[model samples]
Target: MRRTVARRLAAVLATTAVVAAGVAMSITNASAATGGVTGYATQNGGTTGGAGGATVRATTGTQINQALCNRASDSTPIIIQVEGTINHGNTTDVSGSSCDVGSTLIDLKGVSNVTIVGVGAGATFDQIGIHIRESSNIILQNLTVKNVKKSGSPLSNGGDAIGMESGVRNVWADHLTLEASGGEAEGYDGLFDMKNDTKYVTLSYSIMRNSERGGLVGSSETDLTNSFITYHHNLYQNLNSRVPLLRGGTAHVYNNHYVGIVESGINSRAGAKAKVDNNYFEDSKDVLGTFYTDERGTWQTSGNILDNVTWSAQGSENYPAGPSMPSTTTVSIPYSYALDNASCVPSIVAKTAGANKGNQVSDGSCNAQSPSQSPSNPTTSPTTGPTDPGTSPTNPPGGTNLSLGAGADGSSKADGTSYGNVIDGNMSTYWSPSGTTGTVSVKWSSAKTIDTVNIREASGTAGNIDNWQLVNHATGAVLASGTGAGVISFTAVSTTKVSFVITSASGTPRVAEFEVYA
Candidate 1:
């Protein structure tokens, strides 16, 4: 007999009635407002569970669960700060025949507007997972979910490192590192799985590595209620398949890096529509489209880079040949985000994506002032930094971020800080010239009209560019000269190259951002 996923999950899962009671109470106490937040907390489930409430600290899984249980019916959002490893209190008794549900774990069933964020080095969930059932407006960030086991244990929600199901909505998981040592046969399931009508979620800057099963949405082809999920800037490394096996939902996937997909990748079936854009896939096989299952899925692909990718031959079992993915539908993204060119994705993602312990995240399209918002709540960090002249502040307007994924040439560069940092839109990271007299330049494939340039001084390297020359390589014209970290405007000039030449400095010259605009 074929073992259906529903049979494996529902057989021992939490009862619908019991979950509904908690949800009902939560809804009753919840604010009439939706998941969106105001002011400082407009990103990531919009102040989920922590808005206008006191923060609670929990050290273990039981304490975390207890804190959530205490606010089971409260509308006032609470923030549960998790510190250290949340392990222990895992039960082995299976409730039913297959899924091994009803286990004593950190179950966030029947909760709303909750934020479980890891502090310091970030929280670790060792051999245990957080189950989000019948919950809404949740944020799980900076947490390392590893070693979620299924051996001799009644794994709730099919042993997912982070499982969401049954009316779950408005969840933002950022900077999480979800990994597993083994696959399902070794008692491990998906790193992250969403099923049974779960919707309106975003997974950004997270890392899913070294696991056989990465994640899946909508358990089976027939189970099509899940929808509206956005995955951006995530790194999927060393996975076998299902970097999401999407089913029956509109998933906007962009700027993700996939490496070492052993068997297949991105099984989109049962009418699921995936918009795959601007992603980098390296050393992966069949990185997109349906696999193993005969049910057909749909995807629209654009701006993707495939390097050293091998495709599985077309057969009855394999859905589509990869390296070039096929899609059945057109998808329009409902938010604003920056897309790094395929060539630049690897470098850009390496510097910007994943958990940067003490660093803030860039807004990769989550917050907007528009009132006519889609049910799918998006998130991005607030835009700050130097604006390119003659261009919009967010981007170079009509111009490109010349430094973006652009090859950097310098007289010399500091170790770990490459010349690319000067234009990656991140001020915290800078490109320090190896010596005080060294120069850094950004060139384009073709000539670009540039009239203004902005230079951000590295925090510790201020006054390094005491005297500098902005040289136009094409014309060998010194366009302008600067002595500080600010805008340097000059006459409009078209050139294929621009260089920041430090003529004098107090210390080693460091440029955080070297932006040009037309």
Candidate 2:
């Protein structure tokens, strides 16, 4: 960032499990909160931000636009709770009717179930940048957004530290720490850009450094319907290229950890279709393909790990993917993700990429784990809550239920209702949805490594499942959300299916038992 000293909010460790050489790691309690909402913002109908809403406590940027102009509409569903530093004179520009905040940094226009998370002693937006337009379900947890400037003196957003354009959709930006301070002749730009038709997005465990642009999905070259995007376990350092420069559609870079990068990375051009997996590029240089122009883009690499990488020579606008990184193309991916072995991804993204560390993760057989929970900070104290998450569970904690025999389905049900009656252990046999909202799932045939879940509601229909969204349907990872539901934890993940939609319901909603654990 521009350095003015204001970055402290990471401390959590009380052991959840650890083994090392033999690999057993599963840790996740460092004041919990983040371990859900993974890649691709968990597909279209996922990204349950601002859970059930109503939970304000801003600390500037005009109380986060007066908490979205005191929401009640504009897709009501709040969750401000920021604390400390939000420059440009504490962010102004208020107006109301459920807001449309402006003045650069922290814009988020046309709101929709918001969530600007980042609590106590943390939440820096210095030099400002956030500017999502025509918004949709959004969630920007544990922030740090840095330096900014498009050409000097506090002129934000256009400088891109988190710019999403017109048709933005589901966005889940976890543990951020975006930076800038040089490039474009030191005026900064693209730290997370997405253009026109931006769709399902997910930039997990973030940490993009030193600036020089490290963002772009579709902002030109036919602006191709900004497609389904997903970049997991991030940690792009020293930047100089669009660690994200895809131009057309479809992207899913997994387990990231690129370093130094310097002139190019990701660059997929016009018809973009990247699928690079199990990443861990080091000492980068032309981190991926298509640079400059000529319009060309397509990738499908696998199990990548280019240590001390550096490959350049091939002009006419340059085109490097690596010393022998072939694959050219072959990308399908509907959903269902799990891959964490590009040689332990640089020690699990340096103890969990960005934000305050602690939200560590891996458990896909590379060890280390920790997720969900987001308030009352401090495995050392800095205050951050949300992982003891909207509360409901009494002893009904973890302890096996893995959806009992596992194998159910949903999106529509009712009549005699049956998605295997909520996984069978009968809480009076339930599962309803034919009206009043939908989605109910559970499946398994391999892949399972959960992290608490328990819906249980029957007898007089305790609360009528009003507001939910805990996904993982293979790889749409969203893990947690709130509003009536006993026990709902999050962090460890390895899925095979696990939906539980329900969006909103105050009546006519029954789900006798949907238990799950790990």
Candidate 3:
């Protein structure tokens, strides 16, 4: 069952709906929150993290674990108020009959009914990761996790600022700041990641910035069990890709502001489905797509403002939803939410999305108020991590230059050029995208067994192709994914056509040869 108060009617619903249900959060000195949990996290039996439980205080990471350890049982409810900075230096493992404590992180392992909220001036987790494994009914709010190193002088959480795996459930994280200075090359992974059957989670009123991979759901194409997550009223800035690379499952993404997205965003691949509604996107490229691979995902877009967003020419592998983006599928949303007018998302989110901003939230009517109002409406989406484009592949398999005399096709051709230039057996001739990047392919009258492709750049434009995917166009299967174009080989498959998709490029790419071999 599915319904849409989004995409199809974003403008109409804004004026029609009254005060939204569950739109509030308050942290007066952060002693504890009096706010209500909204979004999908309220479903699946509800997530009341440490509500009605004994309150405890923790000034360091070890103390936080101690509070968890000292609980009567793993299921005993507890609220731990955190203050000051928590780093690897101040945190140590503590053992208890009811605890699974560890040093590298604030580990919530095999536990349930917990809330860790920041208080006083605020709480910061510096170079430390919050690890949630096999837990249920958890809430994390009013915190900042910054610059966690995966491999350096200090290490924690393998570069993910907050990672949940191993059958976790029912979490609501709000009013937080998760950031890193760089990409994986600088030892930072995802800002938030969920996998291995984690479900029914919500991330609202937060900010994530200055990182490459935003996050991911379901580690691979086969890990499809994770589902029912929401993200709303958040700000994602200066991120490269994976505004969540969701492999499978359903996600609701709305009322967020995204800026400076370099590579891609909201990559819903591997049959995943998302309800992308009422979000503002600016200065980005491929903001919505089923990119890099042929295992396409689906999104239903409504009232989304794509301001100055650049979309590459489409291909079998590089699929973008914008520049005439429409709903590919309808997503069923179980919770009722009040969507603010998309035009006001940027300002509404800026004042209310992160910690220490008085925990203000939307009234679902585009108004911002303190927790003195009711709780906030439920959330929108969880963006995933990206595919690891491997190293330069081996040489093209030994065979005749099958591309010669083949029918040449592409998404678009630049002025004074033709797609047939790529296969004309002349090194001087070339083809380029009508825009900065696009697709070029070779087709046959019938299927051919081929396993290798070599992309040769036209003279003087050698390094423009930064990331690419070789695909079986007939089946939409990614044969190989890698960085830079040379000779890429994969297992042979019989297909009538193959495409070379340039996902990102430093400049206009010129291909003199798109040679294939069998």
Candidate 4:
């Protein structure tokens, strides 16, 4: 299936090149100098053009590169208006190294105030969509970066599609689409990987899909606010792994939609404070909040609100909420389980109930919920103490647990292969189908480490299952297992489900009782 898709992409790229060749002939270079500032405008010779009434030849990759990169930084921001297709022809092929003839598409180093607009047709690239390094005040708008990956080289460089690295700031990425055209097994890199002290960055109205990693803000404190970074809108599909990993950064993620991710949807790890709110999710294995802290345990989640969010798993909770202080330095809402539309008022009413509630509530707002006040110390004021600014639950409930359960059958599969199993009053037992040979997943009620899982045989006789394995619900790592009837025992991390994958089963195997003892 992956090979078929790659072949189709190659064919499409070839056709696009043929069409682009005819259009490149009539392109005229319009260079203008105003107030001793010289700037060149390239108009598309093709039928489609840009807003600034400029068109350029699309024959050589250097022409596009020069239009975008070679611009005066001191002047009023070089505007490269791209109207038609910017084809980086099939870097998926083994012969190609970078996207085009150059090592990079747009290498902006120590340059500033550059604007690359796609107009209506939307810019398309085969590899390394836009590379920004040590640049500032750049705007990449109305573009689509598709079919980007390292095909020829064994060692793929960072940002196969689009990359921003090393002291880049004040860049706005809007209405962009980055897709890993390679299918699930291809193992491509992320759509966008911004790292190394990249600050004041905003990615909005963009779609990232079908890559090994979706869109990442890593190794630096970056701001990703008001963007739809997910797979549901057909941005990323047929992926075998997670999407959008936030590693070691302070990112504000809000108002996004995530759907049908195989692994962890959004991971906020390595002392990263992720302010998540007002997002909708569906058909996802894991939705949000995998907060990881280093030795300092400085990462925290605050003002991260999840409202009007829906799920597919039966009786599954939204996000586990509570006073969760993994270590002394960092305090976050580890598990917030709330029903749909329960409102922050109910959660606040539930957590701060009675005498403890009265002390924290002042003038209808939560005084204790402020960042300056620790969960252990409610008396501390919001202004005192060294508090993280982009931290706090934006909505109500002060970080409480609420479970809304699965929405519709079209959104999920009832194959009994979840890491956490939510056994509602309707269903008594869940089973994997006969002749199916893969991991079986069961989710738990809450986050708890697993000690043992009891699986009873339901119908078929148990065969020697040396090739079977059990995986953790949250992390998706294989756990230690010993065989007995259908019983498996392993160490637990959180109140997650235990999944069993049958590798070499002779006959149909059935499981009756699946229990996790904490």
Evaluated with TM-score, which candidate comes out highest?
3
Count of residue pairs whose backbone atoms collide, per candidate: 11, 21, 21, 44
lDDT to native, each model: 0.64, 0.73, 0.77, 0.40
Tens digits of per-residue lDDT for model 3, 384-437: 111232222345457698899789897677786779988987767788876434
* lDDT of each residue in 1-518, candidate 1, tens digit only: 22323232332123222321232100111111111221112222232344334578878766665565555354446677777876666333332221212345566666676777777656787778878888777778778888787674644446688999998877778668898766777788899899998887888767886667889998887889998888876777777778898988888888787766777778888778898887878766788877777777888998787866788678886776465575568976433234445554454345444543332332222211122111122222112222332222332334565657556575567566778887777777777654334567888887778888877775554544455667776655566653555677788988887887653343455678888777
Candidate 2: tens digits of C-alpha lDDT, residues 129-172: 88888989888888888888888887887788788888889888
TM-score for each model: 0.60, 0.34, 0.66, 0.43
Which is the better candidate, 1 or 4, if ranked by TM-score? 1
Estimate the Cα RMSD of every predicted model relative to the unseen true structure: 17.4, 19.3, 23.2, 27.3
Residue 254 accuracy (lDDT) in model 1: 81
lDDT of 3 at 84: 97
Cα displacement (Å) at residue 201, model 1: 0.7
Error of 1 at 338 (Å): 1.8
Determine which window of 10 residues in candidate 4 has minimal summed lDDT: 35-44
Task: Please list the residue runs of candidate 3 whose C-alpha ends up more than 4 Å from where it truly belongs after superposition.
Answer: 1-34, 373-518
